[model samples]
Target: MSLEVTVVQACLRSGRGGSRTAVVEDGDLSDAARRTVPGAVGASQAVFIAAQDPAAVRLRFFTSTGELPACGHGTVAALAVLAQRSGNDRYDGVLHSTTRSLPGHAIGNAGHYSAAFEPGPIDLRAATIEEADPILSALRVSAEVAGCHVASVGRPRLLVELADRQTLANLAPDMPTLQAVTDRLDLLGCYVYVTPSSDGHTVARMFAPSIGVPEDIANANSTACAAAHLSTRGHSKLQVDMGDSLGQPATMTATVTGSPGTPIVEVGGTATISGRHHLD
Candidate 1:
């Protein structure tokens, strides 16, 4: 069987360099990720699309290892392709994944688009100080942590706050140990961030080896979780700088509304269309 695929780099900084994603229109193919992802497109994640209704489209994300409950950058890439196919600068649709339903809206034309989505009902919990020891050990860093917490938007991520941006940028995680800790805690990955700057920009990094992503260029799912966690501490709008540790530099924009307990968050940024291909 053959299928058409479009690859886009989402959450780019200065309209260049971001996470590479492959978007495939929904068809009869099963186990699509194992078939095309990382091989045909050389993507970190793959999105399978199916029309749910007249107003929305169902999205499924997969890595080289397995399917994910939801994916932020993948969603943006999928929506960008969908809107371009429909020839509409502004499009509205629902992103239906196995465990979530998100409302997605996108703007701009082909090869360049901006996407935003509302990830509903996130669970935030504080990770005990004892839990921090394992993460610090896994990263091979000193015990100079500021705080630690866990956030679950669509996937679970352990959020670790370091002493400062310098410390955050100087991380070198032991992949084997990180994978072990992720397995023990049943987490999707760990999101490490610094304290918010005066301009409300937070520099962060994401490391997820258990799910087959060693380090994400720009993570939208966990960043929203981070934003929700920040909302509790009296910050609403946040601009996150990620991927610097990898030299692929990406940016993420997040805004949280309403109260801390009941908050609505949107993670969005511009994306560039890299290329497209087909699989057989």
Candidate 2:
């Protein structure tokens, strides 16, 4: 048996550069096969597109660690590939993860594709200065920053505010302690950010020790959660600059609609096909 896969880098030059390789498979990919394929291709995540439909196609994502409940970048990459391969200028698809089903849409041609999706619930809970002090201390960040809060979409991520973009960029997180905090709180990881200029662009860095991704290049879902948090505080739409710590930085923009309590968050970004491979 043989499987064909297309590799894609999502969020392009913005945020932390990341890729999702979509495996063109006919039937369900076994758990072991799912783990083996991505690892063999040297990709952090993989999306398997099966049973295609013009209205919506079935898609699933996996990582070296295990099957993910949902993946924002993975969805974008899958939809982009679908559009490119099918020669459709636009497409609507359903990305079925292990735990949730998300609707995805994409527009573009060939190597350039823009994709968007409605993420799951986003809730922002205020975290007091005292509550976040310990974590900041662990990360060598100060507690004086104003916008510290915890944001939860499908997963919980600590959104910490810093004094400036430079500080956020210079971060060197203590992975051991950071991992402990994420595990204790059952969080996916922490997203540290700051608004340096008057342009209102929020620069950020995502760290997830729980999943062994010390620093995620570009994290779409978490960035959407940040957008929702900012919307609750009066900012509706903004560019989220992430993954600057890594040389291959990427940028993404997110928008939030409706009231703060029930905001609809959408994350949009471009994806480029990086490579293609086959496995048997």
Which candidate comes out best when scored by lDDT? Answer: 1
Candidate 1 C-alpha lDDT tens digits along 93-202: 88788888888888998569998898888898888766667877898777488778989977778998876887877788999999998888888999999878766698
Residue pairs clashing, model 1: none
Predicted candidate 2 versus true structure: per-residue lDDT over 1-280, tens digit per residue: 4778778888876423654455555466577778677777766677777755655466666777766666777778877887787788887776665666677788988677888887767767877565576668768875357667787766677888777776776678788988887777777788887853445477888888777578777788888887887775677886777666676567777877887688988886888887888778
Name the lDDT value of residue 178 in candidate 1. 92
- The predictions' CA RMSDs to the true structure, in order, are 1.5, 2.7
Model 2 CA deviation exceeding 4 Å by range: 14-26, 53-56, 128-134, 196-198
- Estimate the overall C-alpha local distance difference test score of candidate 2: 0.74
> lDDT of each structure?
0.83, 0.74
Candidate 1 stretches greater than 4 Å from native: 32-35
How far off is residue 255 in model 2, in Å? 1.3
**Cα TM-score per model:** 0.95, 0.88
